[model samples]
Target chain A: MISFDLRIDRRGFSFDVSGQFDEGVTAVFGPSGAGKTTLLNCLAGSMRPDSGSIEIDGENVYSSADGIWVRPEKRRIGTVYQDGALFPHLSVRRNIDFGWKLVPAEQRRLDPLEIVELLGLSDLLERMPSELSGGERQRVAIARALAISPRLFLLDEPLASLDVARKGSILNYLKRVHDEFKIPMVYVSHSVTEVVSIASHAMLIRDGSVLGFDRPSALLLTAALDGSSVERFENILHGVVGESTDQLTTIEIDRISISTRHQNKNPGEKVVVSLGANQIILAPSEPNQLSARNVLKGRVKEIWSSNGKVFAEVDVGPEIIVELTESALNELGISVRSDVFLIFKSSSVDVFDA
Target chain B: MSSDASIIVLSFQIALVATGVTLPVGMLIAWLLARKQFHGKFALDVFVSLPLALPPVVVGYALLWLVGTHSWFGSLGESVFGSTLAFTWIAAALAAAVVSLPLVVRSFTAALAGVDPRLEVAARGLGSGSFRTFFTITLPLAYRGVIAGALLGFVRALSEFGATIVVAGNIPGRTQTIPAAIFTRISAGDSDAAWRLTIVSILLGVMALATHNWLLKLSSTVSRDSSEVG
Candidate 1:
C-alpha cells in the first residue's frame, strides 16, 4: 500500500492532493495540467512536497513533521515517462542492464532476460534507442524499469505517446507484466478507456485536488455526471477469434459474437476490440434491410445526460456505453430497462492482438 | 636537445599539464554551474570568468601576489618542496591553467547544458546514484563537447604569453616556453627564429581548432538525429 498527503505551491499553481492507493493498479485520472504528474513525482521522490508525508508499505519515505526524506535513488520505486527517456548513448541491452546491475545479487528477484523477453525486446537488444520506433522505445523503457525489481511501479502516461494500435499492444504487455510479476502499479493517464480497461481503482483529480476515488467505472460515471469528461468515451471488449470469411471475421465475447472487418488472425487467437461510444446506434426496434452489421438486442441498464449529450449503458452480452444527442434520446424515448437494439458497422470496430 | 627543440618541448609539456589539470576541475565547475541553483552562483560564475575579461598582465600580477615567496601559499610550497613556486616551469603551467580555465568552463557548460535533465532523472530512478549517473549517463553523452573544451583549453595554454612571462621569467633552457622564447628571439633581432616559432604556433592552433570544430559538428548531427526521431 502507498499513501501520501502532499502540498506544493508553485508561482502560479498550487498542487495539493491526499489519497491512499491499494495493491492493485490504481490510475490517477485527470485532464491536462491537473497536477497528476506532480503527484507522481512527489511519490517517486523526484519532487519534494512543501508539507505532509509519504508512506510506502508502512515505511515513511518523507515526513515534514519528522524532517525525514529519502533520496530518489534509495526510494526503490521505478517510473516510466511518456517520452521513454532511454539513454540515447546506450544500446537497448545496456539500457536494460543499467538498473539490473545496480541491484545486489541477493536482492535481485526478476531476471533481466525474463523482462527482456516479456517486453519482446530480444531483436532490438543491439540497437540504439534512436533506431527504435515510439512503441518500441516504450517497451524498452518498461523493460529497463522492471529490471531493478522495484518495490512499486509508477507509470506516467506511458501510452500517451503511442498511436491507437500501439497503445493497445503496449496495454496488453503492461497487463501481462502486472499479472506475471504481481508488482503493484500506479498508472497516471487522462484517457478514460485506458483507465477503465487496466486500472481496478481510480482516483479523479481536477485543479490540483482529488475529485473522487473509487472503482474506475464508478468514478468515471461520477465525472461524467459532473460534466468534467468532455472527451469521447470508448468501449473496449476482449474476445477470441471464432470464424473468418473473405469479407469479415467473428470474435466471440462472452455469449455474443462481434463481427469486424476481415482481420488476419488465426482462429482461437485472443483479440481486443475498441469502438467509440458515438459509433454505436441505438434503435427502439429491429430495422429491416440495414447496411450495418452486428445488431444485438439489449436493455438500457442506465442512462445519464452531460454536456448536452445523452449516454446510455446497454447490456449486450457485455456492457457497452452508447452516446447520443439529446434530440435523438428524446425521439427514441429511451429509458432505463427499455429494450433496444445496438447497431454498429463492422468497420467501426478496431481489433488488436490480445 | 637544441635550444629551439627544448623550447618547443617545454611549451608542449606546460600546455599538456595545464590542460590535464584544468579538464577535471573545469568539468566540475561547469557541471555545478549548469545543473545547480544555489546561493553565490552568480558570484562564482563571475570569479571563474574573471580571467577572460581582465588583462593577462593584471591576472599575472594577482597570481604573483598570491603565490610569491612572502605569501602564505608560497611559504607552504617552500616548506613542502624546499623551494618557492615563483620563477619555475610549474609556475608557467599554473599561469596557463588560470588563463585558459574560463574558455574550458564555457565550452563544458554549454555541452553539459545541452543534455536532457530527464535522462539523469531516469537514471536516478533506475537505482543509480547521482555521481554514478553523472559518470555513466551524463559524461558519456557529453564526451564530444568535453574533449573539444579540453582542446580549446590546451590551445589557449599553448599560446599563453603575458601571464607566463611575468610569473616564470624567460630562462632559455629551463622555463622558456614557445611564447617566451619567441619574445626573447624577437627582442634579440632573431627574425628567422621568431618566424619559424610563429608558423609552428599557428599550425598547432589550427589543428586543435579544426579538430574541435569537427567534433562539434559530429555531436550536433548526432543530437539532431536523435531529437528528430525522439
Candidate 2:
C-alpha cells in the first residue's frame, strides 16, 4: 500500500495529493503537465515535497511534520524514468547489476538469472547500450529497476516515448508484470485507454489536482462521457442471447426481459438489461398474437407530464416509469390511480456492460 | 644567416617542449576546478589566473627571488645537478605554465558543468558512488572539454615572452625560444630576422585556433549524433 498527503510547490504550481493505493496497478491518469511525474518523484524520494506525508506499504518514506525525509537510495523505491536513463557506457548486464550491488547480500531479493530470461535480456547482456533496440533498451531498464526489489515501483510513462507498435509490445509486458508480481505500482499515464484494462483503482487528475477516485469500471461510463448532452445513463442494462433455441439467454432487470442483440448467450448467463422509459408499451387488457414477449400488469401510481409528453409511474413490484407520446396519452387516457399493462418485445432491450 | 633559422627552430622546440610537459598537470587541475567546490575557490581561481593578469616582469622577479643563488631551492638544485633552473628553458616552461593555467581551468569547468546532474544522480541510484561515477561517467563525457583546455594551454605556453626572457635569460639554442629569439633579433635592429621568427609564431597560433575549432566542432557533432541515435 502507498499513501501520501503530499504538497509540493513547483515554481508557483502547487501539487496537493492525498490518496491510498493498497495493491495492484493504481493508475495516476491525467492530461499532460498535470503534475503526474512530480507526484511520482515525491514518492520515489527524488523530489522532496514542500510539506506533507508519504507512506509506502505502511512505511513513512517522507513526513514533513516530524521533519523526516528518506534519501532516494535508502528508500529502495525503484523508478523507471521516461527516458530510461540507462548508463550509456555500461552494457546490459552491468546496468542491471548496478542496482543489485546496492542491495546488501542478505537483503538482495531478485534472482538475476530469472529476470534476465524474463526480460529476454540474456542474449543482449554483452552488447553496449548503443547496440540495443528501443524496445530492448526499455526491457533492460525494467529489469534493472526490478533487480533492486523495490518496495514500490514508480513508472513514469515507461512506454510513452515509444512508437505505437513498440508501445503495444511493451504494454503487454507491463500487464504481465502487474498481474504476475502483484507488485504495488503507481502507473502514470495520460491515455484513458491505456489504464482501462490494468488499472483496478484510478485517480483522475486535472490542473494539478485530483478530480475523482474510483474503480476503473465505474469511473469510465460516468459524467465525462458526453459534455453537451449531459444525459445521465443509469448504467442502463437490458439484453439477451436471441439466437440460440436450446435455452433462454435472456435476463430480467426490473420489468424488462432482455436477450443478446446480435450474439447468442447461454441460459441464464447473467445478461444486463437496459430499462429505458421510451420503449415501454401500456395496454388496458391482455393482448394476444403480439410481437412483444413480455406482458407485465401494474397499476398507474402517478401521472407526470414534462417536455410535451406524459410519463406514468407504474408499480411493477420494483416499479418503473414509462414515457408515452401526447397523442398516445390521449388515446390510453392513462392517469394517476388507473390500472395499466406494460408490454414490450425483449428484442427492444439493449444490453452491454456499458 | 644560420643564426636566423636556428633562432626560428628554437621557438618550435620551446613551444612543443613546454606544452608536452604541462599537459597532464593542466588536465588534472582543470578537472579539480570543474568538479570540486572548495571553501577557497575564489582564492584558488585567482591564484591560477594571477600569472595572466600580473605583468611578466613581476613573475620573473618572483621566480628569480624564489630560486636565486641565495635561496635553498636553487642551492639544492645546484648541489644535486650542478645546474640551476634560473637560466634554463625548463625555467621558462614553468613560467609559461603559470600564465596558461586559466585556459585549462576555464574550459574544463564549463564542460564539467554541462554534464547533466541527473545523469550523476542516476549513476548513484545505480550504486556507483562519488569517486567511481566521476571517473567513469563524468570524466569520459568531459574528455572533449579537457582536450580543449589542453590545446588552449598549449597555445598560451607557446607565446611566453616577458617571464621567459627574465628567468631563462634568452640564451640562443639553450633557453631562448621563438618569442625570445624574435626579441634577440629585434634588439639587434635586424627587422627581417625578427619578422621571420614572428611568422613562425603566427603559424603556430593559427594552427592552434584551427585545431581548437575542429576539435570543438567534432565533439559537438559526436554528442549530438549520439543523443539523437539513442
List, residue by residue over A269-333, the lDDT tens digit for candidate 1.
98777787889999999988999988999999999887787899999989999989889988989
TM-score (C-alpha) between model 2 and the true structure: 0.61
Q: Which ten residues in a row have the lowest lDDT in candidate 2 chain B?
A: B1-10
Chain A alone, TM-score per model: 0.89, 0.64
Q: Evaluated with TM-score, which candidate comes out highest?
A: 1
DockQ of each: 0.74, 0.24
Please tell me how candidate 2 rates in CAPRI terms.
Answer: acceptable
Point out where model 2 deviates above 4 Å: A53-61, A65-69, A180-182, A219-354, B1-102, B109-118, B162-185, B188-214
| Residue-pair clashes per candidate | 0, 11
Residue A278, candidate 1: how far off, in angstroms?
Answer: 3.6
TM-score of each: 0.91, 0.61
- Model 1, A341: alpha-carbon shift in Å? 4.3
